[model samples]
Target: MKRRKFLKNSSLSTAGIFSASLLASCETDKKPQVVNKMIKPIVIATWDVLNATNKAWQVLNNAGTALDAVEQGVMIEEADINNQSVGKGGRPDRDGNVTLDACIMDKDSNCGAVLYLKNIVHPISVARKVMEETPHVMLAGKGAELFAYQKGFKKENLLTEKSKAEWLEWKKTSKYQPVINIENHDTIGMLAIDSKGDIAGACTTSGMAYKIGGRVGDSPIIGAGLFVDNEVGGATATGVGEEVVRTVGSFLIVELMRQGKTPQEACEEGVKRIISKNNEKLDFQIGFIAINKKGETGGYCIQPGFTYRVYSEQGHINKTASSYISS
Candidate 1:
């Protein structure tokens, strides 16, 4: 009986070993999971920028670098005399000066910015020159304007009759009201991943309509207005600059993506970070747009009328982002 018992135990042990070996073989044969496979050649931007996305897609489709694509794309908007929120048509500050702010970032982490730069119809291009030709990362006011002129950037009268007329009307009350969803202060912050899967970004704005003179928003501040990490992703912001600057919103989104959050999740969290510190009602608007290395994109805002544009092989579309307050 004892021998029979030992034989039974040995048979059970043999069966267990066979099962273990079979399981190991099956596991070894299984395919490794791939997360968020890379989708090359995509572009995203804040607000209704169909033309800008099309311009960017034109470059990416032609095998241009991400830096060149983003820089060129926003230039279209920057040059648009009808775009009152940026560049040529941007509304003036309280002092009736058309000060533009812009920044650019390349895949290699090189960045450049210009603030309170007046008479430049394409501050985005000037910012690019700063990134490419100068030793400094930022130049402001008269210095920035002089650098732009030195780089052969022609000074132009950016304020248009339409914007100037509005400024005159605004001076009537001189009220310091910042209207959410107005689109008057809409900034064009753009991101692109080229066919090579490298990422770059640009943000350009006339700044908030009727903002105090000499006030610099997040639009031209690296890490606050825009951030790019070739191994991770890139992010850009629009809306009120102070709130975005306070939270380091664009950088926060990229870091969140590095920690494995989806682009949409990262954008949502960035907006929430602002809400978390609030002691009063949210009467202002703030928006963020992000794209991961995988070419997946996402956006979120504090208020409605926040939309982002996308152009890829999948086609161009303007998507309204989910807002924190509406939720």
Candidate 2:
């Protein structure tokens, strides 16, 4: 009986130790859970509502960070000469040179850019370099190209045969079209949120067709074309370059959030503000897309029959063709 009782006591002690170890492990796991709950997740937004945002959304959903997603999405626009007015056969300046510009920013680091670049196959990469490597906020024209080349960026002949043909045709006909220049002011504006919950934005464009020699649009202008703040989200603008620049369109929309306006409200109000002040010819239109920290988004266009593409959670590469109903 004594031996049996001793064995029973030994078993009870072993079980008690195991229970204690299990309890300790459970507590260890709980600590991380508690910490994770305290961390805030990131949100993102882009212009063009669902259509443009969708590309970046897919990248983020695939575990890409917001910056990477934004660049990838912007590349889609750059390569799509047929779809976007920013590059390739879309348009060229009076001299028939394709001057391209792009800029990107990450709210997590407060990085920003303004690049007046030319002959760059990937202006977005140059903008990224400005945000990451240099102390300066902008690089312009040939200077920007030189900087990019120094960074080991290879030169790409941005002009396609189709683009050349268009320019040659323009030289031949040079028809003076009236107001409402439909041929100019179309590019891709994109923003996104990564799985890690960071916000980023990018804008890319080949400047308006028949623009002045050496003209650079607002695409590379940080506040005018693209602006991002992880704290607030991001915004990007498209349309008449001069109008967008003068309005400081993208930053203005984001700033509205600082004043307690929703993303959609901000975008609408920004467009309204521009329209109210500008007395210029009415043919050119303007628009913007944005996302806020809450994952709410907004898009607005000043021109009729304006539509945009978006990539998002509910929508993957959704191209929503919309009309600008006069308010």
The ten-residue window of minimal lDDT in model 2 covers: 33-42
Give stretches of model 1 more than 4 Å off: 1-37, 176-182
Scored by lDDT, model 2 comes in at 0.70
Every model: Cα RMSD to truth: 10.2, 12.9
Q: In lDDT terms, which candidate is top?
A: 1
lDDT of 2 by residue, 9-64 (tens): 99999999999999999988774322223222232333343433555656676787
In lDDT terms, how accurate is model 1? 0.91
Instruction: State the RMSD for candidate 1.
Output: 10.2
Tens-digit lDDT track of model 1 for 52-78: 989999999999999999999999999
